[model samples]
Target chain A: MAEQKQVARPLSPHLQIYKPMLTMMMSITHRITGVALYGGTLLVVWWLAAAAHSDAYFAVVQGFFGHWFGKLILFGFTWALVHHALGGIRHFIWDMGRGFKLPTVEWMVRANVIGSILITVLLWLIAYGVKS
Target chain B: MNEMSNASNMKTPLKRVRGFGASKTGTEHFWQQRATAVANLPLMAVLVWFLIAHFGATRAEVIASLQNPIIALLLIMALASACWHMRLGLQVVIEDYLHSHLAKFAALALNIAIATSFFAIAAYSILKMSFAP
Candidate 1:
């Protein structure tokens, strides 16, 4: 490990150097969730192509989605979707010249975080609550 | 009036344009992605409601719903818009996080290929369902 150590170059100013602020946190979270969204796309494709083919195929997907690991993945997907969706709305608002004020920006970040969780939980509850 | 207008624009229009910063293309791509997302907003709601209505139904039933002209068209539109949006988002992620320039370009190309393939496959599936007897 010591022999393999490489000299590092000056790094781009990242989240570390500055005191974390609400907008910074939201920006970072947006990128993180964007990465998660890639995996979510795979899940979407699986669900679609499985349903497109046959019952057995769809059942295979349904069975996996019914399992614990699958549930966890799906939970992450849901959270990513909701979080990214809200974050995009926040960006859109900023693009339109609203929600840039200090207090509003703080509230927006807090709202995005809280709202994403609440929506994800609500979705899971409804998913389990459904009859079929 | 001539002096006032001339003074208001001291620099030639070309000079003023040249004064603007580099790579207008990036902002155009960003705006296009936002436009697609705005379109997807309503389509997404429709998809959610459609799925809920057909939830847990058999594969045949779901396919039948997809075969509906309106639903098929909407699904294709949604999938295309989504893949485009995903491609743009992932490109930025690659550019930001990937350290090696070669690796960054590779990832960007791979992301585009995957998004294109996903869209193609989805369009094929929709056509198969919609057009097949």
Candidate 2:
């Protein structure tokens, strides 16, 4: 195949070629979280399946979620979810042909980073408060 | 460089090569991805809110929660869009990083299988709990 044929050519640079910046890292983080959510969504799906089975089944799943380790996973999942969601908003804004200015890009990245953390933390707090 | 103003045109390299114009798969994939994303942005918010409300909830309480037709409908909608979006997103990931043709094909197939089963399980569960329990 032509793709298998060796040829001398200038190729795309590795990620190391460019100096890392917050916005660039945020872009990568978006993809990373997107992949993580692929697995994370399974957890939520399992919860629904278990709940559908019976109360005993639901309790087992709920117990796992109550455990510290599961909580950690849930926390990571939620962080990824929020980060990716905000990242999507940034992408949507760009897709709309706005927010292209350098300063605006910087502002959007900063807001995404902070807002994801704040929203996730608030969600967990509310969850705990409701549970208590 | 070609003096044809091709660079300024809206056609992507793949689109120009394939000559399918607007019927190109990439455009459809992109539009669908965005459509699902727009749907998810709000549906996901409502989902998180519902989850928090039911956090650490028992089966009966969770059952009672799903008893509301509106909530069940919302969950089903969220599952449908999220599954579709996830499958499309993962397909792009596979297309980008997997250089081996066989591996890329396998991954894409697996992505579809996994996304489908996940949606099936969750949707069935929601329906079962909603109508019967």
lDDT of 1 at B110: 96
TM-score, structure 2 vs. true: 0.89
State the lDDT of candidate 2 residue by residue for B1-133, as single tens digits: 4443475596556556576454355378889999999999988988888888989888888888898999999999998899999999999899889999899889999999999999999999999999982
- Candidate 2 stretches with Cα past 4 Å from truth are A1-12, B1-18, B21-26
Judged by whole-model lDDT over C-alpha atoms, candidate 2 comes out at: 0.91
Separately for all candidates shown, the number of backbone clashes (residues 3 or more apart, or on different chains) is 0, 0
TM-score of each: 0.82, 0.89
Report the number of the highest-TM-score candidate: 2
Tell me which residue pairs clash in candidate 2: none
Interface RMSD for every prediction, one decimal?
Answer: 2.2, 0.6
Candidate 2 lDDT by residue in tens digits, A68-99:
99999999999999999999989999999999
Winning candidate number (DockQ): 2
lDDT of 1: 0.78
